[model samples]
Target: QQQVRQSSQSLTVWEGETAILNCSYENSAFDYFPWYQQFPGEGPALLIAIRSVSDKKEDGRFTIFFNKREKNLSLHIKDSQPGDSATYFCAASPNYNVLYFGSGTKLTVEP
Candidate 1:
């Protein structure tokens, strides 16, 4: 009950377009949720996060929509660009520890 099923393949987004990545979980014990934004050869940065107690989270051009009842979540990027292109991962932890990360989404924002 500690698994986060994420997209195995990468995604491509054009400039000024919104990219949506998907994630889901089978475990109900998960409580802490976080979405990480990563660039080439760099560790993921904590973009935005939301708890199961909450519904949604947003930060700047990034937004996370979570559904506790459905046990699913998604990340929406506004104004997609070449610079905004990168790999994104959705992660969750039980008791705020032992994070389970998604495979990853490779987003190429073309110009």
Candidate 2:
């Protein structure tokens, strides 16, 4: 099982700069942490989320830096323009049911 790891499949920004994508997970009872943002065909919705006592989570330009004891988590896309590109998923859940996805991260916000 790959537990969950979205090191990176794609990422490139320039319009304004700011496109980081790094996530890690290994169960540990996961704690409902979600972060999705798609724009190709449209599906992934939730933009920011953090549970496990919360470490950080924003919503405007997007931001989420959680590290529940090093479970690992990251997703920051500020200024980055160009419609913020697309493709970004780093999810996990062990409370609100099952939900584990980290096979995506193709953001190219170059203008």
Candidate 3:
């Protein structure tokens, strides 16, 4: 069974609004969580990450809120822009080993 899961297939946000992408995992063994952003005809790139020991991690415009007990996490994009539109994937690794990726959430930032 897949360990990581993304409930939403797609999400839309107006420019300058914040977009929240939700994710969850079934494996308690999973500790490290990383989110990947990918554009069309391109490979996924690492956006931000959080460990089991951390409840939150933040980058420039991206932030991750994690709950170890709930086995869930969310990626918040502040001041979403049209360029921020992409397919975001939630991935988890156990002991820094193989990574399991979720289906992915497609985000569209409308102007």
Candidate 4:
């Protein structure tokens, strides 16, 4: 069964705008979240991440907003560029053990 869920199947954003990808989880045991970005023909790479202890995590133009009580999170891509277009997967783990991934959200950035 799927434990993680993404709200959007696809998203579009213009250059310099912020792209938001939302996610939620069913397992409260999950403590670690890693958002992965994948380009065509390439493996997903760690974009940004957050622990249940942190309500937010920011890395340059990328930021993760997490709400442990709500069991939800969102990834914000600030100043989005065309090169930022890709598929993003939200994954959760219980004590860094097995990971549960959400169906990816494909992001399209228009310049």
What is the TM-score of each predicted model, taking all chains together? 0.92, 0.32, 0.97, 0.97
Model 3 Cα shift for residue 84 (angstroms): 0.4
Native-to-model Cα distance after best TM-score fit, residue 39 in candidate 1, in Å = 1.2
Clashing pairs in 1: 10-106, 11-106
Q: Write the per-residue lDDT of candidate 1 for residues 1-111, one digit (tens) a residue.
A: 438978556888789999999999978999988988899899999888989988878889888899999999999999987888888889998895588998888889899
| Per-residue alpha-carbon lDDT of candidate 3 for residues 14-70, written as tens digits (9 for 90 to 100) | 999999999999999999999999999999999999999999998998999999988
Candidate 2, position 91, lDDT: 87
Deviation of model 4 at 20, angstroms: 0.4
Report the poorest 10 consecutive residues by lDDT, candidate 3. 91-100
Off by over 4 Å in 3: none
lDDT of 2 by residue, 1-111 (tens): 778889889988799888889999998899988888889877889878888788888888888888888899898887899987999889898887789898988998879
- lDDT at 58 for candidate 1? 84
Q: Return the lDDT, model 3, position 10.
A: 99
Task: Please report the TM-score between candidate 3 and the true structure.
Answer: 0.97
- The lDDT for every candidate, in the order shown, is 0.87, 0.86, 0.96, 0.95
User: Of 1 and 4, which scores higher on TM-score?
Assistant: 4
Q: Looking at candidate 3, what is the lDDT of residue 22?
A: 99
Instruction: Please report, as a residue range, the 10-residue window in candidate 1 with the lowest summed lDDT.
Output: 1-10
